[model samples]
Target: MTRRRPPRHASADELLTELGRLTQQALERAELQKARVELAEALQRELLPAELPELPGLRAAARYAPARHGLNIGGDWYDGFPLPDGSLAFSIGDVQGHDVEAAAFMGQVRIGLRAVAATAADPGQVLSRANDLLLSMDTRLFATCSFLRFDPATRELSHARAGHVPWVWATPDGRWGLGEDEGGLPLGVLAEESYPVTRRVLPASCAFVLVTDGVIEGPAFPITAGLDEVARVTRAGVHAEPAELAAAVIKVADLTGHADDAAVLVLRHDRPPA
Candidate 1:
């Protein structure tokens, strides 16, 4: 005798129960996603220095603003600390992506650089060690960084860039120029490479400006004239306070789209806050 087959159609109560179960699962997943995003952002902020250092004969200020607030936290970090030899070190960098993983990676690189810099103080060497750290993680991501170490007694500032954005330097005589020089590869691009450190005796009352990509670029926003605008703005306010100078420079950039995060750090020599 052939056995009767089970019913093909589910009862209304069974269907309702399944639907409720699915709805609960979806709600739980959404909440988990939100929590993850918040945690990542908090971690990113911790990586950056809360304020610039207070150094003799030197004034500094920095700001880090997310182009748009939310889960899209770009990998931008800025730091300033005094070395054992009574010198000050400033660094700004951007990791490859504007996602959670990039932000997390940024923290690790930032801390590693700081730990190595305290002993090395050579921007190039510090970055070389930091690069090794990144490669060891095997994250398949890279970062662009600019490091500046200033000597208070000599009034000299040494810098190194690893495929990072160009920094602006304004002389006391109102001349402004980009600090672009021959350098090595960016971090994570290769397992081994060396970066060159460029040094100069900064003129008294001079100012240097460091910025991330967001300040120099945006979504189709006057790309051809960005440098000219930056020069003009920086030249006019070369003598402003570090904080004011950073704000003024950023105010003029085409930050309309809020497409990428922006970071600005200003170093002023013998210039009092205004």
Candidate 2:
């Protein structure tokens, strides 16, 4: 019969040395993580527009906040630009995860939308083409977005959604409501999915609010409640400047202790000079 040797115990010096090595490794890993986060944040900032476009009758503003609990970088994004046909385009979206990959995918989605919007017939077609573009990429990430094209000449706004939170709109007279439009599957979900467009004329001195889900959803806060808070704030600020209203809307995330990244885009049609 073979007898097993007595188990050997690590000496005090060896134990201390091992602990030191582990501590160094942990520090190295932490530094690496920090560097990655910084890189991701820089990338995100580069991708997001520096300012929302301003048109003759339309005033636009947007605000973005990183997650309060997790990594400071995320996939929430918003953009505003003018189409070739003289219409203004605005979009806000959230990619699947809150990591570097998600940020990269967000850039891709934004580029796709901009590329397709040039020739796309409407908001629905724009989202559909963007969806197809994402599926063509060699990636598994998905995204949700709300897109709008506003024609300054006609005061018409066409909106489309892809599994995104509904927008909140308010008129100067204290009327407000949620978008509640029919939406399609998120980008990269189904190859054949098609988003539907909803159109309406803007009333004078009215505002439309678009937000990523993070702005209105959290561990302890329900989206419905958050949305109601946004509506109330918007109703009160319908006559305020787009920038002020956007700032107020984004403040709800902090007030509600929302842990995820948030973004708010406010579009307002100012009343013509009397």
Candidate 3:
């Protein structure tokens, strides 16, 4: 049997040098991650609408908050604008992720919805066309959305949902209820999903609330209870301004310690001047 040579051992100085090099590399990687996170946050801010439009008799306000325990970026988004035919459109959605890619995809979805709504007559058509648009994109992510078209002249509210949570509304008489409307599959799930529209006449001086799941559901909170709590809050603030009501609704997420991003949109209808 051949005798093996004595094992050569590294000197302490050489080991210390290697340790220092590793430590430097770790610090550099941490800095790089921080820079990337900052960029993502900036992109998210740019993707969201800076201000909601205020129509003649309708007032709108929206609020958004990042998760308390993540990269501080997510796919939750809310938008409101006037359509070409003098109707106002509002949308709230959550893309399936909590990263930079999700935020970018959210922007794309919002743009697609706007393009489709420009000519689409009702909420259902807008969501259907937008769903097709999302499927055509080279992405596997999906999203849930609630789209609404309000005709101020008739007080008619047309809504369509795509695997999204129920909306809450409060009438001027202090009565509140959840939407619980029929919905289609989430966007990007199928090639051409048809979202059925639900039409109802909103009472004058009514408050309509739309929110992402993050606002109502948490690890420690059940969704049913959360929905009830939101309804109660809406009832209490039925007479408040749209901005105040939006703030009050978003505050629920902070109290629940939710781990996902939260978004809330409040639309209040006041009878046009008498």
Q: Each model's C-alpha lDDT?
A: 0.80, 0.88, 0.88
Q: Residue by residue across 184-247, what tens digits does model 2's lDDT show?
A: 9998988968998999988877899999878888788899999999999999998898999999
Better of 1 and 3 by lDDT: 3
Q: What digit string (tens of lDDT, one per residue) describes model 3 on residues 1-274?
A: 9999999999999999999999999999988877766766777789999998877778999999887764646689999878998899999999998788888899999999999999995999999999998888869799999999988778898999999999899987767889999999999999778999999987667998888989998889888877887898899999999999999999888767788889999999887876
Higher TM-score: candidate 1 or 2? 2
The 10-residue segment with the lowest total lDDT in model 1: 251-260
Tell me the TM-score of model 3. Answer: 0.91
Each candidate's TM vs. the true structure? 0.82, 0.93, 0.91
Tens digits of per-residue lDDT for model 1 on 55-142?
7679888877775655556588888888999999888988888777888888888788889898898888988888888888888789
What ranking emerges by TM-score with the best candidate at the front? Answer: 2, 3, 1
- Write the number of the candidate with greater lDDT, choosing between 1 and 2: 2
For candidate 2, the lDDT comes to 0.88
**Among all candidates shown, the one with the greatest TM-score:** 2
